[model samples]
Structures are given as structure tokens and as C-alpha cells.
Target: MSALTLAAPAPPASAPPPRQLRWLLRLHRPALYAWTGLVVVLGALLLWLGGPLTDASEAAWKQYNACGMAACTYDQDAILLYKDVARYTGSAVLALPFLVAAWAGASLIGRELETGTAQLAWTQGVTPTRWLVAKLALPAALVTAGTSLLALLHHLAWSAGRGRVDNTEPWYSIETLYAGGPVLVALALAGLAAGALLGLLLRRSLAALIGSALVTGVLWIGTFLTLPHLWPAVTRVSSLRDGPSGSGITVAEGLLTADGDRLAIPRYCGSSIDPACGSLFDRLDAVSFYRDYHPRSHSGPLLLVATGILLAVAVLLTVVAFRVLRHRTADRKGAAV
Candidate 1:
């Protein structure tokens, strides 16, 4: 009699662990969709600005320039229209950092920690460090990519209108400088870091949101104030009668006297040619009208310096966030024991 020993079915194999990135994507699907939609819409707007809007604006500008103020009637409306479009587009690009900060604070880390999901995640085979890395890295990569693309598009659009559109902003204008270069990417990343750090420190979604916004605003303002000083300014000395020349970012312009004193031009000296101004200039022995400016060539160096500073700050914030998290984790383990 053969002993019928039924072979036990092989134990079911455990499913492979879900990837960190996949889990992050699944958790923040709404953010992903929102970001995708924003990029698409902005991209379309930039294309239009570079293409049809640019053409229309240029045509209108030509017509206006050709017609004397006395003869201007046909395309006056187009000038205003172009200005409106440019302003709106610039505003949208400039607002990206604020949006990134808000999302990072309210949704990315704050909400997760606030609701205890971050702790839950750690229990599911994810370490706190890995969780924070996933949170920061994914958003940072997306922000850098999106902002970089938009900046390139913006630069193209702005370049297309440079010589043709009379009303277009100069290259060194603050909005143009920030929104149409890699600086925007740096700002976005900085905002993300600031938000994350605040979220971790505050541990409450609303508080994190407000604190992050304030910190981001301060960073932006500080950058704006410090930018002109990032690179050496070019000094031009021209005849007091002729005022300074060369189109660049003027840092300070005043009278350079023969005695080497830098003094503001007198109010009475409205024009260099004014008799009263000429008298004052002669009396003061003003040698020349001096202008300190950041030449167009300095643009690259300034941008690089500012971007490096912002990145350094972001890295600092990230390191502090990790330290805070590790401390909190250790405290919890100590209590449990």
C-alpha cells in the first residue's frame, strides 16, 4: 500500500515591496496633476507670447513709431494690449516660488506629519530618512525641471521682442532678471527647502504654511537687495554737462567733483545745460558726472553668484531638517524603551 502523502502546496511568495518613488507618486497624484497642468498652461502662454503676440506687438510698435504722436490713431490699442500680456505672463512666472512654498508646507511634509501618516509610513518598512529624502528629492527635481523649462521659454520670448517691442522690459529689470533665467529655479528650490524645514520644525500644517511663506518672502527680498552688489559695478565718468552714458543697470549716479566728493546732483540742476546747474557745477568744481552700473556682461556672473548662494542656503536648510528628524526619532525610541 503506497502511503499517499499529499505534497503541501508551496507557500505563496510575498509580493515585492513597492518602490519609494511609486509610493510617493501615488500619495501625491493630485500635486503631480496640478503641476503638469500648470506647466502646460504656462508653456502655451509662453509660446503665444513668442509667436503671435510678439508679431502683433512688433507690428503695432512699428506703426506707432512711424506715426508721429499727432498722426497716431491706428495701432495704439495694440501697444496697450501687448503691455497687458507681458505683465500678466511675467507675474505668473514670478509667482512660481510662492506656489512651490505653499505646496511644500501645506501638502508635502506638513500634512503628512500632521496626520501621523509619516509615522505610519515608517512602520511599513520605510525609514524616516528615506521618507524625507523621497519627499524632498521628488519635489525638488520636478520644481527644477519645470522652472528651468519655463525660464528658457521666457528668455526666448523676451529675446524675440527685445529690439522690436518698444515697451518690453529691459534685460536687467528685476522681474525679467528673476523670471527669465536659472535664478527662478534656484528660488523655487530654496522655497521648497524653507517650506520643508518649517514643516518639520513647526509640525503643524497651518503654522508651517504661514512660516514658510514669510521665510520665502524674506529670502526673495534679501536676494533682490543683494543682487546689485554681487558683482563689481562699472563706473563711467563723463562731462558734468553730458551726464553718464552706456545702457546698463545703474547702481548710483551722481556728480563727481574735482575734489573727489560724490554728491547728488542739485535739484536746481534739473538739466546739465541749465544755467543755474552750470553755475553750481563750476562752483563745486564738479569734474564729471559719474555713474556706477552693472554692465550687461555682469549679468552672467551675478546670476551665477545669486544662484549659488540660494543653493547653499537650501542645502543648509535640508541638513538641519535631517538633524531635527533624527533627534525626534531618537527621542521617540528612548521613550518607548
Candidate 2:
């Protein structure tokens, strides 16, 4: 009897709870490395763009300006190089939002759900809400920090070239403005949210990737169309000889009648410098060419408004994703309990 009692097997040892955050990092280590590498490269390029490249371009522009009416050699290669670098780099910076959306949709959330890893983790001790929060919070922090840094550098680079490099984009140029301000950062955050929502909804990586891209593109285009109207534009009136004239984002431009009524400028009637156009302007009772537009000063207001809207959207999407996820898994959770 003593031997039989001693031979009884010891109770099975209990397993410890899962480490959600650690496991998450291990699963997405590849994406983490890739994102880090990309940020470093872009930061270095932006620094060069704002420093040596800007200086070289400015010098070339000065030389070109000094030539006057005479043919003289200038550093054309330097000018071209600056132009190419600024264009390509700005484009890349602006495209970052879409890239993030694709990755977040395909890899971050969708793949785990598709492969049943997400379910397995839930069964192992990680609650679904906690899991989703971990996924969104960590990536959102990384994306915001990286994108904000790049945007700051891009803005400094463009600012360095402003008024000095003749070929540089104006402050109001859509791509330049978008890349060099808070709008880029906001868009990226929105993209991350959009991708996450799509992933949970579709539960398929490929479909979610495509859907995220399309949704982000639509949001961007809508912003482009709506931006000019977000802030009040200044009105400037110039003589008919100068045509409708003003800089920055043009909201509306036409002719003003003597009674202060706004009228459309005639077709093929650009300038009063042209006798035919001058005659047309006179017959139309055009007092002056009027332009309602935003100057460089309005960029701040526009950006702030746009950024606020995007952030609100991101928050809304995040909340909805959590709700949708919970609703879908509610029955399963109840049964498990």
C-alpha cells in the first residue's frame, strides 16, 4: 500500500499566461526592421536635400539670373539634380501614407486573422480587445513618430530652397504643402486606422490591402478638392492689363464689373496686353480682374483644419473596429466562458 501511494503521479504543472506584447513584437519583427530602415534613409536624404543640394541650386540660379540677355554657362547639372531630388523625395514622402495603409492591412492585422493565429492567441489567454489595442497602439506610435520626423525634415528642406532656388515648388503647391506639414502625419495616422478597420471587416489579407489603398486614395482626393475652401481667401484686384492675378491657392478668379458684380473672364481673353482681349474687357464693363485666393499666411489654418478632420476620422474608425470585432466574436466568447 505504501509503494502504490508513493507511485501516484504528481499533478500536471500549470502553464503561465501568454505575454501578448512580446509575442506581438516577435511576430512582426520583419516589418519593424523594414520600417526603421526606411525612416533612417529618408531622414538622411532630407538632410542632404535641405543642405548641400539647396546651396548648389541657389548658386546655379544666381548664375543663371546674372546672365541677363546674354548666353553664359551655369551649373545646369546642379540645377537639374536639385529639381529631380526635390521632386522624387517629396513624392516619396507623400506616398508614405498609402504604403503604411497597405502594410497595416495585409500584414499587421489581416494575416493573423486569416491564419487563425489571432483566434489561437485569444484562446491562449489574450482577450480580443486587449489584442486589438496592442496591435493598434504600438504601430500608431511608431508611425506617428516616424512620419512626423520626416515631415519636419521635408518642410525644412523646402523652406531652405524657397525664393533662392528658382525651380523649387511654391509654398501652395499641393504635393509640397502636403509633404511638408502636419497633413502628411495626419494622413498617415488615418491610413493606419483605415487599414486596420478594413482588415477586421474583410478578414482576408489580399482583399483588405486593395481596399485600404482605394479608401485612402479617395480620402486624399477629397481633401485636395476641399482644402481651398476650408479657409477664407484674400481678394486682390488688378488692372485688366495684368489679367486675373494673385498667388497661392486660388479659390476663384474672374472679372469685376463697375457695380462690383463678379463676371466670368471671356475665353481667349487672358491679358489686356492683347488688343482683342482689351476690347472684349471694355465691352463687358469689366472694371478689373479680381482674384480670391489664400496667401502663404493661410497655410497654417488650412493645415490645422485638415489635420483635425483626419484625426477625428482616425479615432472614429478605431472605435468602430473594436466594436465590430467584439460583435463578431461575442457568441464564441460566451460559449468559451
Residue-level lDDT for 274 in candidate 1: 79
Best by TM-score: 2
lDDT of 1: 0.85
Runs in model 1 lying further than 4 Å from the true structure: 1-16, 19-21, 268-270
Model 1, poorest ten-residue lDDT window? 9-18
- What would the per-residue lDDT of candidate 2 be over residues 86-189, giving only the tens digit for each residue? 88888988999998998888888898899998888776667788788778887899999999999999999998998889988999987688999998988999
Clashing pairs in 2: none
RMSD to the hidden true structure, all candidates: 5.0, 4.2
Q: For residue 314, what is the lDDT in candidate 1?
A: 89
Residue 166, candidate 2: Cα error in Å is: 1.4
Q: Give the per-residue lDDT digits (tens) of candidate 1, residues 1-337.
A: 2345666554322321457446865899899899979988998898888788888888988777788866665576777777887788888998999889988887898988999988887766677887888788878999999999999998898899899889989998876888998789998899999899888988888988888888899989999999999999988888867767657788888888778899888876744687878888888888788889987799999999999999999899889989999899889989999
lDDT of all the models against the reference? 0.85, 0.89
